[model samples]
Target: MKAVNEQEIRASFANCSKGEAKRLALPRDLAEQPWDDLDFLGWRDPGAPDRGYLVTERGGEVVGVALRLSARQRGHLHRGMCSLCLTTHPGSGVSLMTARRAGQAGRDSNSVGVYVCTDLACPLYVRGKKLPDLGGRLEETLTVEEQIDRTRAKLSAFLDKVLA
Candidate 1:
């Protein structure tokens, strides 16, 4: 991942209007983000918890998507896995995130949803940079690079579904 400016981030959005992307909230700590360690930049809007954003580089261009988090938390006691990183969490640590499909399908109210870490910090979690207290991290048979590759592939697949 590379460091990106606000304008670049705003212009990267693919699933929403340019105006909406312009108005969407960006992380306040963007300057301090560990860009080299990120597969994507993701954050929940500080003023609007239900609103989330994700941006990743694809084919040398940045692509972003706006996501919505479900209002109610489900199965807090159950073990849940994030589709992106394969990290297990107490259900409360995971949330259903839905992104409106790109173009006309979005206008038709079509969306793609997946269970992801509620904080949307899978990259950090997978690298052992940030640890959640509730659910223990999964022991991995693969190397860190392999795990990162897996995460990226899964997330790219999800993004493809949204754009399809």
Candidate 2:
């Protein structure tokens, strides 16, 4: 992934109005983010725990999506896996996040949901920069590059669904 500025990030949003995107919270540590290691920029809003966001490149152009975390609760003993990276977490580490479909469908209240790491750090987890609290780390025969490719593919598919 490439390093992006605030204006680029704000303009990339597809599911929300421009004004809303402008008002959405961006990471305070954006300047310090490890852009080279990132597949996408994702974060949960500090002011609104249920709200999350993701920004990534799609076919050379940036695309952004706003996500809402499901209200359902999970037990700490129950293990959940991120659909994108396959990292397993004991509880709140994984969440059902839904993004409003882009355009008119979004106005109609349509949304697409997927189970993802609650922290929205799938790339970090896949690359071993971050570890899931419960599973330690996933063991796989695929190389780091292969894992990164796979994770990005999953994300693309999810974005495709949202855009559809």
Candidate 3:
């Protein structure tokens, strides 16, 4: 990730209002982030936890969206998956991460949720770059703790960008 100017970051958020952009706590140094492994950047505003956000550089521009927590106990199997990484969390793999919308659009933007991973693996880490296929069962190749750490790493990077 390279450093991004405020103007550039703001422009990426064309769908948002100027006031919303001004209020967001975006990262100042992109170089400090681990861009190689991140699926997307995610963070919660320190001043307003209810005003979390995510930013992904699509094409050549940064696209950010304010987010909110939507914790719901979804039944296993058919629940939605994370918007970034496509992993399933089974009985515990679901959180409805709704996005903050424009003045009037928010009232109807229910579909723009964060769709958190059931394990909530942070997007910055999580071994999104896979190693060679292991020669054994999935459980034998990677321990649960290892799996969580990878996810957390990704999440931390995104959080840093947003909270910075």
* Best TM-score among the predictions, by candidate number: 2
Better of 1 and 2 by lDDT: 2
What is candidate 1's lDDT per residue for 38-99, written digit by digit as tens?
99999999989998999999999999999999898877678788989987788678889999
Provide TM-scores for the models: 0.96, 0.97, 0.53
Model 3 scores a C-alpha lDDT of 0.53
Model 1: clashing residue pairs?
A: none
C-alpha lDDT of all candidate models, in order: 0.92, 0.93, 0.53
Q: How many backbone clashes does candidate 2 have?
A: 0
lDDT of 2 by residue, 1-164 (tens): 99999999999999999999989999999999999999999999999999999999999999999999999979888889899998999878899999999999999999999999999999999889987775755679999999999999999999999999
Off by more than 4 A, model 2:
none
Name the weakest run of 10 consecutive residues (lDDT summed) in model 3: 131-140
Best by lDDT: 2
Ranking by lDDT: 2, 1, 3
- What lDDT does candidate 3 reach at residue 148? 52
State the number of backbone clashes in model 1.
0
Q: By TM-score, how accurate is candidate 3?
A: 0.53
Per-residue alpha-carbon lDDT of model 3 for 1-164, expressed as tens digits? 44455676666663367787887887654456666555565555667644555666655667776666665565555545454444545544446665545445554543354566533334432464332121111343576556655555654444343333
